[model samples]
Target: MDFQLIFLSVPLIFIAYKLFNRLRFKLPPGPRPLPVFGNLYDIKPVLVRCFTEWSQQYGPIFSVYLGSHLNVVVNNAALAKEVLKDNDQQLANRNRTKTIEKFSKNGMDLIWSDYGPHYVKVRKLCTLELFSAKRLDALRPIREDEVTSMVESIFKDCSAPENKGKALMLREYLGMMAFLHITRLTFGKRFMNNEGIIDGQGQELKGILNDAIKLGTKKSLAEYLPWFRFLFKAENEALAEHDSRADHFTKKIMEEHTIARKKTGDTKNHFVDALLTLQKQYDLSQDTIIGLLWDMISAGMDTTTITVEWAMAELVRNPRVQKKIQEELDQVVGTERLMTESDISNLPYLQCVIKECFRMHPPTPLMLPHKANANVKIGGYDIPKGATVSVNVWALARDPAVWKDPLEFRPERFFEMDVDMKGTDYRLLPFGSGRRICPGAQLAINLVTSMVGHMLHNFTWTPPAGVRVEDIDMMEQPGTVTYMKTPLEAVPTPRLAAHLFRRVAVGNV
Candidate 1:
């Protein structure tokens, strides 16, 4: 009898141990995690939507397991502030996936660099040397020239006898234009702009860079279950291939710059020149500088194009909106010339249209992962040290509690209240908010808004042949920067006076 009683008590002891382990973490409420895989089975095609659904069921803050990693997703404004602002210092380090770290060159650049003295120093350098208002003003000529070149290129293509009134790939045109603008500004050199078209080796190099970035952004089950990495051998191979191509391309450019620097001692006023100037002061190497250059190109080029394309797609889908914006532009900007960057603020409706697009389609939907430095309480949940915290701004943008008709695309909504995008406004953060907000926010905004303003001022866009307005696919490819699955194709006919289209171009106005 005594032996039997001791055996019965053993089962109770085992139960108590399991309970203690669960209680120790004090993790926020979430769906029960399964053995081995955790919550991996629950993730959907679109991560933001999946998080949005989970937020509704588990409240604003909840814990999730991507394999063994604990991810705390914030889906509301107040909680976003608590994580992104109140505890920013504790959560300043980026939570890089293994693949991303390889692409970031082990945190050599701005976007993926860990929070530390070097990150701080480099950020200051970028702020002062690259993105300062004075620097931006000085680069106005470049922006104007590129914008005019893009407009001229489009007009030429559409006016051609073979392509007249046909569906021109607008998004493709804009993507190349964005690439040209960024590369030219970055190195003070131009490529892929022969006859105002992106072709030849310029296109090839851009493709290689894009392929590598896309590889880094691609989701990996191995990130969660490290031991299962062997299952993703194909992904690993693709990553290495693209990474090698990117490294080769960037190194070639670096060599060219070095040769130019030595021959004439003529430093072009560009990012590479600035970094080379302080190479000794910062103790930076060629590899480190190349990594940083990749960071800038990866972060800058595609996002501006994505934003402008989404904005244009929305406008074309809603003709009333397109008409309304054109009327506003005609009134304020006038058909006499293209809109200037300085005139951005003066056109409130255009701003509102941009705000609406950001609301629906943010460039970085997950706002880049931020890792906790130490254990902290966020929204009454135990966010363990080293845990990843991601603020789903897309979920917040569509929170009915935050906005009326959260999913609807309505620019007029902005007219009712004052909403800004300068990282201060959590409600509409296209460039994110708080300590880790995008360093290049000002430049990106100017690129997107100015492009849209000029496009609206100069042309009347309609849905391409055979495509109904309602048929536009707003579906996005899931990644760090969600690109439209179907490229935006449109028929752009110059609505402005012929002289304004021809004489003023983009920058002259």
Candidate 2:
């Protein structure tokens, strides 16, 4: 080798050594990411599944830069406690993507707000006013009525001679039910009828919400690669239009509520009525009210639908589990009458199935990604400030060490243990944990459990003929929440009498 070439190689070697040492020593252990794209290619499609796969390669706690920003995925139940419990106050701030930020109106709502007095006050107000245990219990009839309407509609469909024992679009029906439920709870009336179709102005508002959710969840390149900001300009413009239209519709509803509440002396107890009362008490802005309303409608409706759909899909895929739940329902909630919310406590098997579903397919799998406000150390690695930290609840629930036969849809595993799902036990925190835990967890529990109970008690579900249980599609469509790639189509035969599906003339639904 030439002496001049040798002289140049020494400096290059020293520089390379220093760079590699800094990266290896400073950053948390994780999958080696590409230069510009970072971990985008690795976690494409479903971030939860990709993060789980990486947890096996690197330890449970590892960092992967999502493009330019560092994202640390915490998949360990033990290490999760460190972030959600030990340092919840410090790490309470939300780490939103550009897309999430675009819709948030600069952290206007309780869900996306940073950890501060505003978040605390708003959260407290919302929890007490809308979703407290007492509030949910008092409003339980709203959910019960919606469930009644849903079962009645399904019963009517099943009663048809041609539709008898035919495959019903379970996901579509559940989504409609959730939509009607949240609508009635928010506005005190059903915009969508029992047939799962929306009416006139309601139809227009539905389109607006649908368009916003679709655009909000659609991944944009600028979110990952900042230099490609020009790529999302068109998307940003479209979102702005959707936002403006949606805001107009929301404002109209608030205006209507304002007038109605004024006439009725603000005596109503529905969600909007409650918010109207709190709006005056707290001096909250109209924009804040709209953002909070959007949060309720967007979160309460879709996530509930997806979760119940997952549970039903898993049941239809596992006939033995279906039979077991049906048997429990039959025993606890007899054929003469329908399953009530109170009956949920008597049916342990149904609870197990619901819990298993929560573990297997959590509604918000990534638990709304959080941003670290300050430098923190976890699992013996340094997480620099401003890194996006999200717990891979999907991965944690399926950990082989924590769960036996993690991939199996066995509800029996839950029956054998006493693990709780209210984010108390980190192992199966479906709703999340800490200061930012889901405010509506209690309402969700009541709604999901009661709905599932009613469904199983009212019908006998079976897969379409010739489709083997193992052959059912379990593939997922990743978005704001991970939903089944295919709609769950199953045959529902009425197990209970038709009259039981209806309520008295004076009662709702």
Candidate 3:
């Protein structure tokens, strides 16, 4: 009888708390949340789409309750600027979910850390040392070598007698290139051989990384319902296990780098080496260094690949766009040699194509959730302290009000308007805006541009034999990064000299 009474009183208490806050604050209008659960059932698997749908009904700036948590979603350029620019400092903190808390080690890393001195210090380190233009320029050969290796791999596959004219899985090649490039940049070595086979350590790291992603993405009821925490014992155990495994690999790598650095008396340009060399200088802790290293890996690994894959999908779907880019490539970088990163500036059409791809399919549709450090008013709506804010970049890109023929996949639109995606322009915020904008935005752009330019300049992409160009899938798979729903498969016919497809040696840059 006593237990039943306590159980019944819980809902009553929850309702009263919600009501008191509702009366005290002028919260933005939203769907009527049910007691206790608070719109938990209303949210869909694809969260960005659900938010956009609700925005259309409740207006651009609306509220949603994810189990008593007040979430404010902004769906247009104006609201975006308000949240990301005008109120950036007040809302610069990250909203840590159960998974994020586990993955980020309670905000020790750059991406997940709260806005504070630690965040400021790490951001400075990244800007002045890690992601500085000088450092990125020093790492150019790794980028070029990996891209060329991809071209060589693809050429071999397409040139084979049995595989001739057949659809090749572009994701495999692209994924490998992304993996190799990131690992090399971070660790100063490749985990896989030239034949694309993972070494022992590579296999172990790959398994741990895959498990981390799965565990990180898994939805925990405990996150939304605090009373249900005891039910997720196994989930917590899994996260802890992931943490242990990640620490093992990271520490092992650190040890190896430390020994090598002492022997050589010189630090390599790779992230691991840089972190070790700067560890004492920056007053970094072991946890912080590990966190920052994995932060770079987690942030950089898949984003470039996703962007390039989406761009290629569009290029395949629109042959005219493909032809125009190839024409520009030919004009700027002729058939005598492959396109290099230097030629990216001259190939204006390629840049436009990439920008259009970004506008249409920003790799991360929803910017990372920002937590309010203080009570703020955005778009005349009261955002209470601790409220989580999300900017729907996807919705903003597709809004008919902001873009003319927003649904059309035309690269030519960029030619008409000069929109900057590096945080200055609110309308095309692929990398977000203000203080929390991606630090690696330039590096990502350069790699993506180089990869796409080379692919188009080296080969002509088309849908498989039976698949029509129009029938190619453009739907996005739901995750933090919006990957293609159907992994892209295309037929490539070499457009350059065979020798141009050979892999280039990446001498020390």
lDDT of each: 0.79, 0.80, 0.89
Which segments of candidate 1 are over 4 A away from where they belong? 1-21, 196-204, 230-238, 465-467, 497-509
Superposition error at 149 for model 2 (Å)? 1.3
Q: How many backbone clashes does candidate 2 have?
A: 1
Top TM-score model? 3
TM-scores of all candidate predictions against the true structure: 0.89, 0.92, 0.97
Spell out the clash pairs found in candidate 3.
Answer: none
Rank ordering of all candidates by lDDT, starting from the highest = 3, 2, 1
Write one digit per residue (lDDT tens) for candidate 3, span 1-509: 99799778878988998889889888899998987788989888778788889998999999888888889999999999999989999999998887787778789889999999999998999989999999999999899999999999999999999999999989999988998888888877788776678899888878987997788667678888877787899988988888989899989999998998789888889899998899899898888898888888888888888998999999999999999998899988889987788888888888989999999999889988899999999999889999999999999889999789998998888889888889988899899888899999999999999999999999999999999988888888878888898999999999998989998867534
What's the best-to-worst order under TM-score? 3, 2, 1
lDDT of 1 at 322: 89
Candidate 2 residue pairs in clash (backbone atoms < 3 Å): 95-371
lDDT of 1 at 389: 93
| lDDT (10s digit) by residue, model 2, range 248-312 | 88788777878976886654666766777788788777777777877888789988998999999
lDDT of 3 at 255: 96
Question: TM-score for model 1?
Answer: 0.89
Stretches of candidate 2 off by over 4 Å are: 1-25, 193-197, 503-509
Model 2's C-alpha root-mean-square deviation from the true structure amounts to 5.2
Could you tell me how far off, in angstroms, the CA of residue 363 lies in candidate 3 after the best superposition?
A: 1.0
